[model samples]
Target: MATMQECPRSPEAKLGMRVEDLWDIQEAQLSPTEKLNACFESIPVSAFPLPSSNQEVEIKSDATLSEAVKILAHHNILSAPVVNVDAPEDASWIDRYIGIVEFAGIVVWILHQSEPASPKSPSTPTSATAIAAAANGNTFALELEALGLGSASTTSGNFFEDLTSSELYKNTKVRDISGTFRWAPFLALERSNSFLTMLLLLSKYKMKSVPVVDLGAGRIDNIITQAAVIHMVAECAGLQWFENWGTKKLSDVGLPLVSPKQIIKVYEDEPVLQAFKVMRKEKVGGVPVIKSGSNTPVGNISLRDVQFLLTAPEIYHDYRAITVKDFMTAVSSYLEKNKTAFSMSCEFVTCKMDCTVKELIQLLDREKIHRVYVVDNNGDLEGLISLRDIISRLVDEPRGYFGDFFDGVLPLPANSRV
Candidate 1:
């Protein structure tokens, strides 16, 4: 693991520094105070405009299951914000932000509602069997425009209507509702850090695109995606050693800023099922929720969390009967009980803000953990690092050649003997 050192502040020492000046300047390179002040700063949101609201797709809360599906499909969306059709336009119906109904939710509902006796014989199919089979087909292929229940037959309507037409059109009342899903509490970095530090931090965090904030003005600047980081690093490496030997701050590079509103979010108290639904529908990794209007983030729920809950029989059973409060484990609890009470192998990993990327990677690899919480010296979470961050950086890179020589046989040049 890399060691931390203090930075030199003497003006005479830094006046005409060169790349070689940094080789023995480990103390100055790793000082948290120096790096923190130099590398980390907040960018304002105004620079990056908030994402425009998605065009609302209105659906009656009581619409037939088929109608709901049609609306989702027609809009080419994964979920449609629901509303009460009978309510007046200015009724402040915002309180009625009833949870979104997503394709995943619909699938789960259908799977649960399916009768066990309907398909005992695999060879001999029944009406329920056919419906199940069709619904189980490539869900991704179903056009986004063909998601709502209203246009069931026009796309997959015959399958839905044939199975549950009577219950859908007659018993379900269509209410008016409209809304879009969002993810939030996103962190953006400025271009002041070295390509190496950016690579290290990004690999540690498992982020796709980190929004860049302008430290000077405290506003969103641009975005630094995994691709951007890799390209920048590759370019830096190609420079002569004299040109690229020293550490570079984040701002030295030119990364644009992104706004907080561009991030998606959900309430902390929301059902985990709803989180899963939105993730599936929007095709995002996770959602960040605030503790209310405060900028302090409560917690983030990701697709991996949902998958873990679903795959664990005990967890899934408990989830069916319990609320989010019942399952949520406070982050503080994990830190307080580290190593002694909580076995490193089975438990999550965490680190302080001062931890280096090399240290984080070793810990993650050794413990086989997916993510680690980054805390301050006081142990309060500052951010999170995950395998996704590492993998994202490697996405477009070419694989090395070690695998081709696994047998220990070496290929000789065309004109030479083995």
Candidate 2:
């Protein structure tokens, strides 16, 4: 909401006063949120991951699914726009966007296709059976030194070979698995909208990123992601902001409350496909595992675990038959080989229910993750928190508590740059 007048003017116009002095004078006129929003809006979309003209990363609908995964991995992205270059000559500009392709969508499509024409039910245990199995102490116990703790299984080497050599994956088109954005209303932001508005959109929809549209041309301008938002707050804001936010507990800051019934989870004995079912249904990146008869969380599995598909296509060939435990171990083995700090056992970062907002932010920043599970004093999973949830809640705080920073302040013009 800041205007040119609110920014530091040139030295010639300020006479003997320095630009720093003028900036401080103008900065005093806005609230903390507005000042932060102005700081964010000042940044350009091109500086981050703008995919409009990039050919290497941007994909067409006809590209093979394997090709798509390779591109995403090469660029280190989770999704991208599925552009349609062969639009009808008579088609309107708005109809040209087509849809989006995400890793989750690809997983869903592949799983759907992997089903047998007359599928045999997987030996996945039901909730009751799983609990019984756990009580019998027959459940797989993780050991730090064993293959179960994320070490790649020496027995599964053939699994990868079978997958990459399969004809099913080689001929499958990316378009077949891509989700139509129109179904979700294709959430797009105007290039002119403030970064605060962008944050609200992503948080409201639980999206990792949203496309920025050049509304006039009906074309995507860029994609803004949660990572970009974190970058803005961390690099643009000063230490005073963090200290100020630290004093407040997470409960006071309006994160969605966590309840046992609402927590999406998987049994330790279930087929790995069940975990994917939970993720597809809930649109979540991960799910916690709970032992039968216990309220305490034991482990977690996520889409990141599925990234092994890009390198070890064999993982996909056996994914439907693979148990969640087996998949986690394979991913762990892969990460160890790549020298990443994460372990399937160590990746489930958690915080106590009473932790401060500042504490949550710090953990996320240090780990470079999007969320943390909030647990009670007894170590029971209570809720989940994400970077987007934190940013949205902070920005949406009631303005009454800040007194009248908006008083006597003129609204910035609609076309204002900064």
The lDDT leader among the candidates is: 2
Query: Ten consecutive residues with minimal summed lDDT in candidate 2?
Result: 140-149
lDDT value, residue 201 of candidate 2: 60
**Model 1 CA lDDT for position 341:** 34
Q: In model 2, what is the error at residue 410, expressed in angstroms?
A: 36
- Candidate achieving the largest TM-score: 2
TM-score of each: 0.31, 0.67
Any runs in candidate 2 off by more than 4 Å, and if so which?
Answer: 1-56, 88-96, 113-164, 178-184, 214-219, 236-242, 291-293, 314-321, 340-346, 397-418
Q: lDDT tens string, model 1, 250-330?
A: 122211111244555565555544555566556556555545545445565554343223222233232323233333453
**Candidate 2 collision pairs:** 160-314
Candidate 1: lDDT over CA atoms? 0.39
Q: Residue by residue across 1-418, what tens digits does model 2's lDDT show?
A: 1232344232222221222232344477787566555544553343344433354246777888778777776666667777666776445434665566766566555443322223243332233334323432432211111212121222244444544444444656765443422223455666665554566566654667777777666667778777656544443222344445555788777664546678888866666656776676577777887765777777778765555654565544544346666667666666666654332233668897678776676677666677788888888878877777777765553334324523543344332111
| Candidate models: Cα lDDT each | 0.39, 0.56
